[model samples]
Target: MKPIVAIGDVHGLEKWRSIVDEHEDCTIVFLGDYLDPYEYITRRQQLDNLRDIIELKKRRMDDVVLLLGNHDLHYFCDRALPGSRYDFQIERFAEAMFNANIELFQYAYQQGNRIFTHAGIQHSWFVDDFKGDLTQPIAHQLNNPESIQFNAMLRLGHARGGRIGKIGGIFWADISELTDPLHGYTQIVGHNRVDDITERCGYNDNKIIFCDCLRNGKYYYEE
Candidate 1:
């Protein structure tokens, strides 16, 4: 199997560009949070860099994947909602990301149900919950011809939390729901920034891998 390199929470593109340039053989999975909190007015440059990276990846490899995060969802909300509390820079950065057609949730799987998503999968999903292949319609819509269902799925209650039962935003549901007998998969996710290389949750079975070691325009790889 090809080695996997999952990038975490890149609000800017410079850092990712360097990493992408260096790791041509390993498939790079971008774990979302592509907008918000720009330290400088380089939104244009950063976005251009991101576009270049995407184009390069698409040309050079067949497995590059982009996983969407909650912040990415904010950009997709059509209008900025109240109490968002997101950084001011997000507005412009989000616009740029949307223009590039980046959205939430990207996945890659290899060997023994190994998968990479922006966040963890729930532990309680039964066999019935999954239509087929676990990814099913979500992946099909993305891969098929002119499908509107993919975009529609994004509007589901699970995408955004509200005054309702536990909606399981990208981070919580995807990561915590691996407790059921039918659920079995390892997912790489981003959202909560972690200074360390790895963080574990629930029993020894469930885990969330955060790759936020690099800060201030640099890519840090662990192991």
Candidate 2:
């Protein structure tokens, strides 16, 4: 099998450029959160970084997969929603960019029994909110607009400051909200920040790998 390189939340960092360069032959999956950098990185830098990532996708259409994270979804939303470090100044530009290349982004990706999503998927949330067919490929069901509601994917659980008893959906799920990984699939995701790449096992030993440690110089590689 070809190698797979899963990158973590970018947050306007340039380390992804090097990771991609080193793994040019591998399937590159970005776990999203392309914007909203730390205090030091300027808004312009974040915008430029996003443009570069989009360009890379254009160049390597088949090899690269971009999943949308909560940070990114705010820019695409019809109106302002809750997001950390949201910049009103770049909203128009970022929205335009995303709208133009929206086809390149997706809610999930699947290969064999492994799935990739912006935030780890929870079993309860899938059963309650996902409108897609469980028998089908998870990514296919998610990417097809006819199969799911766009707004449903944006749900935020109580852990991330939403209503009590609610579990966040794919794009907005917090690590705390995911008590167990989705049944029958090993999921790789990035959303909640971590100090290093981490893995957790749930029911039936299903695996959920968290790789949102890019700010600390880390990524997940599989062959």
Per-residue lDDT tens digits for candidate 1, residues 165-196, read 33233333432333321234444556545565
Cα lDDT tens digits, model 2, 154-205, are 7778998889998888888888888788888899999988899899888765
Evaluated at residue 177, the lDDT of candidate 2 is 84
> Candidate 1 at residue 135, lDDT?
50
Q: Model 2 segments beyond 4 Å from truth?
A: 146-148
Judge candidate 2 at residue 18 and give its lDDT: 91
**What 10-residue stretch in candidate 2 is worst by lDDT?**
143-152
Q: Please list the residue runs of candidate 1 whose C-alpha ends up more than 4 Å from where it truly belongs after superposition.
A: 77-111, 125-167, 171-182, 201-205, 216-223
Candidate 1, residue 192: lDDT? 48
Clashes of each: 12, 0
